[model samples]
Target: MTQPAFVAPGVVTAFCPKPTSHTGVVVMVAAKGDGVVVLDSGMAEPMPDALGPALELLGATTADVRAVLSTHGHRDHTGGSRALRDASGALTYFSADDEGLAGFAPDVPVTDGDVISSGDLRFEVVTTPGHTAGSVCFYEPTLKLLVAGDGVQGVGSARKLPVYYESGTRYRASLRKLLALEIDTLVVGHPLAWRGANTHVFTGAQCHELLEDSFAAAEAIRAAVAAVGPHPTPHRAALAVLATSPIFDHFDPGDPVEEDTEATLDSELRDLAGTAVR
Candidate 1:
């Protein structure tokens, strides 16, 4: 298909592509002006078929891209980075902590509070680390748009709780930082882009409620693990807990479970806890 036209006046478009076995790849692209900045690049595959069309719509090409900004280092988000860099000769930008995961070291290592500007568009970095150690959210205050990676998904997807939290306490604090922003449009990585979802913006009050719920879910999972006794396999323990989490429950009641789902969940939790321990 011809690249989807730029959805917003200043924003260009492209698809993130399905990567992981679980979810479809999100549509990833850039919003360009004086400089070009790309969001996620999709899987660690070749340049997506839609990439050319999206760039064309912007009156640009991969060569015009100045920098690539990734919310985190997941394979799906960083997969196309190397190819894009080869194509556009653009510098990559990512959280310092995520350098190894994303493959390429960020030429521009973004820190919290860093402001990136391109002509009239400006993006402020918000360090939101619940999903991963270095996950971040890019906010364009003028447009009130938030490019939140996995920290928060679209309306129906479950928020990937920081399985690798350096500090559970700090991760929660970061969520508070996001909730405090004056966000009107939330452009998340997974699922579709959310526009004009103001009424659903989680307010400070609502955030606290969700935070508590998340913690409660975690605690229940933990409790179930404890009850399963010391020798319980991590995979089984996690599955038992996840089976009871309200977040998982919110989805369809009888969806078929992936054969390796429990194992994958265990691996993710281990990774998350390992980060916390370090």
Candidate 2:
């Protein structure tokens, strides 16, 4: 576990459990008055107490956690929610669209613009459906901080390609939506890289730059899939798409991009067949 880094007047963050692992979560804590909120709990089993460091830094305990917010339903992000909630008796907020994917029912189903308040910290939910149908980002406009989880993946450190199991178009759109926000500090679930730099945190202009690169990387994959036609297997298609993009030049080819390639191609093929039938 890494030490909790002070993000703002009331916010602090730490990459819980294995900081370098893509499967680990970035735990963020915000407090004001007597209430504290935790965002993105790590996996439950291996490191159920992943938020300990951040909580300690805040000089609080599980009892102070009034709400636990999940950026998405993925286990890495939500698996630890049960443990935390059990300890803190906190309300868990998740998106309704992702109820099917989550292991446990949420205390509250959040919408696109729901404002969650804890003392002076007010986090506005920004529903970004692409990484997953229910993926959401928390934006603290007053602090210009955005806890994005996996919502803005810019070619993550573990893989050469960005992965969005849902619609690539929607993923790109979500990135664009995030770009419109006034973000100075951006924290993500993984140590995603752009060009040659890898980090889970982005500040000031780096936030915009990271979002742009992520958007462009997704577009490059979309275009590459279209150009490669539909004859190749998903794996082969991924390789072809990779060969055409210089953004992946330094990284090793991995399975993550293949998943996205398959999803993107399948969507396009379905569209084409629909057009033909029409």
- What 10-residue stretch in candidate 2 is worst by lDDT? 19-28
**Model 2: per-residue Cα lDDT over 69-156, one tens digit each:** 9899987788878888888788999897887777777899999999998777889999998888999999988889899988988865
Q: Supply candidate 1's per-residue lDDT for 265.
A: 46
Candidate 2 at 274: error in angstroms? 6.1
- What is the Cα-based TM-score of model 2? 0.88
What digit string (tens of lDDT, one per residue) describes model 1 on residues 104-142?
A: 687789989998888888888898885577889888887
lDDT of 2: 0.75
Q: Best TM-score goes to which candidate? A: 2
Q: What is the C-alpha lDDT of each candidate?
A: 0.62, 0.75
Q: Could you tell me the C-alpha RMSD of candidate 1 in Å?
A: 5.5
- Candidate 2: list runs displaced more than 4 Å: 18-33, 46-48, 254-278
Candidate 1 lDDT trough over 10 residues, lowest sum: 192-201
The deviation in Å at residue 132 for candidate 2 is: 0.5
